[model samples]
Target: MTVYDNCHLGHARAMMAFDILARYLRFQNYKVNFIRNITDIDDKIIERANENKETIDALTGRTIASMQEDFAMLGLELPTHEPRATDHIEGMIKMIGTLIDKGHAYHSAGGDVFFAVRTFPEYGKLSNKNIDDLNPGSRIAEDESKKDPLDFVLWKSAKPNEPSWDSPWGPGRPGWHIECSVMSLENLGKHFDIHGGGPDLLFPHHENEIAQSECASDHKFANYWMHSGLLKINGEKMSKSLGNFAMLKDLFVSYHPEVIRYYLISSHYKSSLNFDSDSLDQARSALTRLYQAASLVPLQESDLHEDSVKGFIDSMNDDLNTPEALSILFGLAKSINSTQDAQDQSMYASTMKELGKVLGLLNDSSEAFLQYGADLTDEEISQKIEERNQARNNKDFLKADQIRDELVSQGILLDDSSDGTSWKKS
Candidate 1:
């Protein structure tokens, strides 16, 4: 669960993929110590900070806070540990020293250090790529001072006014890939349960990490490697250059949080999710039915009934099949809506809650959520109630009906009882 917020809270597709894997691991009773590292001191961070006329600390801090807020809105739990690259300089330096001692890294004349990719026998095992076949492209250039063109930098020579740390190599900072190696080793030990990120990291970033960690510790880095698919906008890769990238904060203003969450989770973890306003609207409408059904049923504690909830659990267990699980939930919602018996409705309600506990959806009532942005004052609602009561008492059915219609249009539902009239948000 190592996420790099290179642009922001990351693409929604990446977050959904992590959420599914985390939920599935927890369901299977695994003590998963998930750690998502933050590359707070990257080249991009410095560039963005400079463009905004802000300090590096301020840029990273604000983006991290916004990322946490997005995670909360999606109902995602925080990672066990969040290590920032700037905060773990000591740990990174220690690991780099170990690599240098093990002859896996070398120092250049200009005070820059690079990893010796040729020294590692299984260099491209994780990515299943051959060093001979790797097209260096623009990533590798002719720096005659270096041993090999393919070898990437382990420590960079700092420039004036840029962030730097004191190291044996020189007064420089750790490379982008080294940060994860150090953070993972410090937080989750040399060998951890799982390592995950976007599919794009499988190449240079993750491959380089393997080279550094295994060479330093002489042990496996992660038992399992998982990666989520990239997000596209309308069948095209999202990029700032193309002007197709959508900001998470901008989208949040127009769409409900649950709607966006549903859209992200509807597709499989390893599949690309093409984001659009229409698709999100469809997800919102689909989830609205579940919320509407849940609203009709009275609230009750979840009851354990494995037999009835097995479909939902089985779908989730099969590599977190959220689409299938949602289908099962829809079927249950239909059952609740079509049934009339009081006892059956109560049983259905309990079953729905039990299923919702696993899916992390349909847990909130429609009434409660629809009241998210109401401008009406409490006194106004009370006055309307009083007027409705007065109309009913005076036997003016037409006037009472008009008032009730106005309330309904404003997302309020009124139920008339013999004793009085009760109201709730529609």
Candidate 2:
């Protein structure tokens, strides 16, 4: 499950990664129950709400809607269940009670309840770090009332003018870690096939979830863990202080959402993807190649190459190696372009589109994808092509060349054939 607080491209990478996995699993005939949770209430939500001078619901609601829109823009499949942290408060309260009863948690003199990390012997198993190796006071939040510095809070005491909910201990909210644990367990039960999130969450956030859930239920947590690597701006980590962070909406103004999705999926999910103009240009160029080849062949309802589909499924099965899968796609596109046989071209195009659909690419018409984000419409380009043809027919070679050059300047490439003229965005 993923969390949301001003969701960015980094978050989109993780979402797309799991989305592809879910899609592939369903394609493989698995009954996949994908769940992505929204962290509606948290320290960040409170801080942002107070700063914006708005109610928590108002801020969270707006942000959540915007996030959903962004996900759809990137072609992400909606999850099976999307639970908000606030909606599962009763389950959180009950889980915290179980932890306290199980001696894995305690209420401090202050209203907060803290988890006893030392009691959980396998606390650092996921991260593979020893408790003794941890810096004496490193990574632990500053809270003086806790018995130990590493003991994280399960429930946070409400401060003045903060959002509060009814609880046995007092009016407070669950801590960040407890929210995911209760939500996942209540919805997916004690055991699920797999759990996934961003790499950063694996340490404290997911680590804490495992401890709390396992201790509370005396059952194992998720069988497998999947974490997508972080996204960087240029060559460095994206942070507000660095001034290199790019928001999703801002990127959409400069590039098509499909282009951004292509760039994000060009690399392996476990590898860091550096965002740069050149990388985006490469993605656009590559997608242009696929669309150009797609345009050469007529749209067929069914025509597939068994070998190509097998290669695609193999690459996807091998840990979802999308980069390799794309290589197969590009190779098929090359064959489609080189082939003169109409039947073979159609078969190649069908195989390419079928494989690309697995990765959510090439679904748009060639004209649509090629002309997207262009300054001129198809009719405008066609009219310009007609004028150029008339100029050529009148033996005005210079005028025809000039018209073609003008269209080229506008990012349109015109191809003159005996049949007529066809155009595409450069």
- Scored by lDDT, the top model is 2
- Per-residue accuracy of model 1 over 1-426 as CA lDDT, tens digit each: 222233422365776678767766787688878787888887777777888888888877777887888777777767888888888889888887888888988888767888889889898999999988887656656666678888888898898878898888778888888998998999999888788888878998999999999998999998989888777877876766577887767666555677777777787877877776688668867877888788887886645445557877788778778888888778878888999976677777778766666656665667555443334555676688889889988999899889988887876667778867666544
Where's the lowest-lDDT run of ten residues in candidate 1?
1-10
User: How many steric clashes between backbone atoms does each model show?
Assistant: 0, 0
Model 2 Cα lDDT, one tens digit per residue, 1-426:
232345677778888899889888988889988888888888777887888888999988888888988888888888889989999999999999999999999999988999999999998899898976765365666788888888999998889989999888898998989999988998899999899898888988888999999999999999999999888886776654466777788777656778888888899999988887687778889888998899888887666888888988999999999999999899899999898998998889999998888798887888777777668767788888889989989999999999999999988887768777877767
Instruction: Specify the poorest-scoring 10-residue window by lDDT in model 2.
Output: 1-10
Clashes in model 1: which pairs? none
Model 2 residue 340 CA deviation (Å) reads 2.5
TM-score of each: 0.86, 0.93
What ranges in model 2 sit over 4 Å off?
1-6, 239-242, 376-403
In model 2, residue pairs whose N, Cα or C atoms come closer than 3 Å (at least 3 residues apart or on different chains), thus clashing, are none
